[model samples]
Structure formats: C-alpha cells, structure tokens
Target: MSIFNLIVALGAVTHKDSDHERVLIKRIKAGDNKALEELYELYKSLLFGMIISIVKKREEAEDVLQEVFMRIWEKAHTFDENRGNVYSWIVTLTRNKAIDRIRSKGYKTQEKASTSVDEPEFSLEGDKFDPLETTIFSDRAELVKKALEEIPEKQREVIKVAYFGGMTQSEISEHLDIPLGTVKTRTRQGLIKLKNILEDHISRNG
Candidate 1:
C-alpha cells in the first residue's frame, strides 16, 4: 500500500478494541502464524511510520519494520498486559529498535562519513516553518516540534542543525562558527532535555 494509505490504516487500528488486541497477542504467543499475520496487518503501517520518523529512509525503515516484527514474534510471550496495553508495548518496542539503529556503530560511522565534498550547506531559505515538512509522520513531527519548544533556544538550534540538517557536531560548530565543545555540549544537553519532555508527554498521553 502507499504511505498515505498506510497512515490511514494505522489511524483505523488506533481506536480498535483493546480486548481484541490482547487476544491477538495471546494467539501470537501460542505460535499461531495466522494471528501474527493479523497483528501485522493491524500494526505494520503505524510501526512503519514511526520507524521512518526516526530513520528518515524508506528502505531502512522497511528493514527495521521486518526486524521489529521478528522481535515481536520471538518475544511475544514476555509481554505483560498488566503493565501496559499491547499498542503501547508495540510502540515502545518500535521506538527503542529505531533508536538502536540510529545509535548503532555502523550507522554512526556511515553518518559521519556520508557527507559529500561538494554538499551544500543546510539552510531554511527563509521559508515558513512547517512541522509536517520536517518528517514523514505528521504526528511525530508535531511531537518533536512541541518538545523542541520546551528546550532552550541555543540547544534547540544546535539540535536542529545536528539532527534534522544531518550535520555532524564539527560541521555544526564550523557552520555556526561556534566552538566544537559548545556544539557538542548543546547537542548532548538538548537531547537529554528533549527526551525528558517527550517521556513526560507520552506518560501523560499514553
């Protein structure tokens, strides 16, 4: 299905009955491949959107989605409904897996060396700001924007350059004419603050 259709499918599943989800999980734990397929049909789009939001590459997201389902299949028996609903569990699983991919040594090495010699500087070109334009998943883009608004201005700016702009710390420092240490500090502090804010938001809304 197209990405747009996938997002709509995700929205449809979001409000589905929790008991039905729980039953599906139970069946999955019992080695029912058909139940697994049913679960995948319901959650694949939602999880795919989430993976894309973090990785920003369709191919990588697709690979990660397969890995995520594989993990779900292997670990289904470990899920505890008493602690949280199935949907939240799946979301946490997907986010953690995506973040793991982002932080992987191979990914870091690739990201650091990926910059082309003739690459142009990342710029806004004075265009109007739009959160949806920042990410494939509009809901995640909004959450990120809201979290950014709660951070200090300097930290927020550095993070945007480092992450959304796909610039390394040194590149960000040189581009902004700031000290490398300062750039690193802001990136670190900004991420910690953003994580706390997002965690709180999720807790309140979960």
Candidate 2:
C-alpha cells in the first residue's frame, strides 16, 4: 500500500485486538501455521513500517520482517500473555532484530557505503513526512496528524522535522539555524502538547 493508505489503515485498526491476538498466539503455540499467517496479516504494516524507519531500506526491512516472523514462530511457546499482549511482544522482537541488523558489521559497512554519496535535502512538506515513521502509535496516526495541526507552528515544525524528517536534534539545530538547546526544548514541548491534544481528540471522538 502507499504510505497514505498505510497510515489510514493503521488508524482504522481499533485497539480491540487483545482477545483475538491471544487466541492467535495460542494457536501458534500449538503449531498452527494458519494462525501465524493470520497474525502476520494483522501486523505486517505496522511492523514493516517500523523496520523501515530503523533499517532505512525497504529491501532490508522486508528481509528483517521475514526473519522476525521466523523467530516468533520458534519462540511462540515462550510467550506469556498475562505479562503483556502479543502485539507488544512481536513489536519488541521486531525492534530488537532491526537494531541488531543495523549494529552488525555487514550492515554498518553497507550503510557507510550507502551514505558516502551526498544526497539532496528533502522538505518536510514535500513527499517525506510519512506518519508511520514517527514515534507516535501507528494505530492512532490519523488522529495524531489532526492533533499536530492544532499545536503551535514552531513546535509542530520541530517535531515533524525530528520525527518524520529523520533528523537528530543537532541536525535540526544546524538545518534550522537554531541553537541545539532550542531544538531539544521545542521537541520536548511539542511532544507534550501533542500528547494532550491527541488524548483530547480521542476522548471527544469516542
């Protein structure tokens, strides 16, 4: 799916998967491949989007995604639903695997080679502001996008650059010609405002 459609899909998925997820995991533990397929269908977008953010390449993210499910299949018996839900467990596993991939010698070497060439800077308003890449919950992306519009322009700009633009605070400082401290301050303030705005939006809508 296009990123736009993906964001819509993420938002449309209500937080009602707990019971269904538990059943899927139970079946998976019992060696049901169909259950595993059902689980994959449910979470692939969120997982793959997160992997892309970390690994920075669609192909590598796809490979990492397959590896993640394989591990899940092998480790299904170890899952403890009482401690946490399946979504949390799978997301944690995917993140760790993606982090490991980036930390590997081969991946490091490849990343260096990939970044050796200069690349053009992208505008946040242009094509790169994918909501899925941000730290916000994927399942609330559309709401978060609307809530973002309600924040002060300055705060919203910094938050968007930090998250969607994939830039560090220092990078944002240099790019925006602002102090590093200012960048940090804006990001923190922006996130706090965003949380409040998002919560209010959710409450009102529900």
Give the winner by lDDT: 2
Note the residue pairs that clash in candidate 2.
Answer: none
Residue-wise C-alpha lDDT for candidate 2, range 1-206, written one tens digit per residue: 22222333344344444778889999999999999999999878667777676677767778999999999999999999766556657766886788788768998798777755322222222445353434235447556677778888988888766543446679889989999999888778877777777557667777
Q: Candidate 1 lDDT, tens digit per residue, 1-206? A: 22222222333334444687899999999999898899999877657656665666566678899999899999999999886667656766776688688778987786788673222222123434342333323455466677788999999888766543446778889989999999988877877887777668667887
Cα-based TM-score, every candidate: 0.56, 0.65
Q: By TM-score, how accurate is candidate 1?
A: 0.56
Candidate 1 residues lying further than 4 Å off, grouped into runs, are: 1-17, 116-206
| Candidate 2: Cα lDDT at 58 | 69
- C-alpha RMSD by candidate, in order: 9.3, 7.1
Residue pairs with backbone overlap in model 1:
none
